[model samples]
Target: MDLDRALSISAAGMAAQSTRLRVVAENLANRDSTGQTPGADPYRRRTVTFTNNMDRALGAPTLRASRIGTEPGAFPERYEPQHPAADERGYVKTPNVNSLMEVMDMREAQRSYGANLSVIETTRGMLMRTIEALRG
Candidate 1:
């Protein structure tokens, strides 16, 4: 049925967004993480990529988490001479993650997941109603 296809599509979307949420959470948790050794690189922000793939059974394109990769960029430096990760010049390389950006990404992922869940619930409700009417 078309409703079954709807459920499948929405479920795929929810799964993809779930991965995004996890990545965002990890980035936020490591916002202040730094390398232990002098002049070593710190944590890099993670990025999630979404892709649409053909689902043969559903005969439709479904969303998926395509890749989870690190964001390539220079780490921000902080003047912390006492920190173990500090370089010879007294500059510590902090993680590339931004707390505010991670929070925003998290919010977007949550909203996307919630929207997919709502679609599944609505489709299920409609299917149930159809079955109930048929038995009448």
Candidate 2:
């Protein structure tokens, strides 16, 4: 019920979403990265996992990025015989990062961040109104 509590919660949410956004950006940037050696693994897409932890200072549960982990799966291979990273079978392992999926994840993170920001703004407005009422 406290405005400060609301602000703290929203701030934690924003921080979590910010980490998600950063992970998405990193995945997109390294989407095309390939290993220099033949049969080597290419870049793996990184994922953000959030956890709800009790904030002793705020006395409320807040969200945080628990870990940044890589997505585990076989990389898609392309027939590129001449490529340095190509295997003996003439197949090159491509990054597991999917552009469309990353874009969707980015959009979701943006929406969450915007929602938290909106809450913070609303809390600020309510606090200002309360101050004015007391002054009157």
Candidate 3:
């Protein structure tokens, strides 16, 4: 495969991973967020979805973030009678965001992003060498 095509594919992957990281960060930031009023819903965790498509311009497969959606898991309830957002039964709906899970996801996204960046750097180096050889 051509170096240019490899660079394009890697760039697309890096972009997708960047979006995933952003989504993970948002989830972590809102993990403890609760509803403003009693019986109101709190912040829902957002999930990032990706899809691969053929980039006609690049003539290669590229990845992109398809959509950002909410998780289907039910919100856990915490008993907090004194809290203003608590229900009549002294139970308050808490966001389903888990700190550990978010951390793991963030790590994975970071690793993937780094891998794509490495690929881009390697490809650029090879291209530069090829140009230097041709000139020499």
* Top model number, TM-score: 1
Q: What are the lDDT figures for the candidates, one per model? A: 0.94, 0.96, 0.92
Error of 3 at 102 (Å): 0.8
What TM-score does model 2 achieve against the real structure?
A: 0.96
Runs with alpha carbons beyond 4 Å of true place in candidate 1? none
Model 2 lDDT per residue over 1-136, tens place? 6789999999999999999999999999999998899999999999999999999988999999999999999999999999999999999999999999999999999999999999999999999999999999
Off by over 4 Å in 3: none
Error of 3 at 116 (Å): 0.4
- Candidate 3 residue 83 C-alpha distance from true site, Å: 1.0
* Residue range with the least summed lDDT across 10 consecutive positions in model 1: 24-33
Candidate with top lDDT is 2
| Residue-level lDDT tens digits of model 3 in 82-123 | 888999998889999999999999999999999999999999
Instruction: Quote model 3's TM-score.
Output: 0.96
Model 3, poorest ten-residue lDDT window? 34-43
TM-score of each: 0.98, 0.96, 0.96
Tell me which residue pairs clash in candidate 3: none
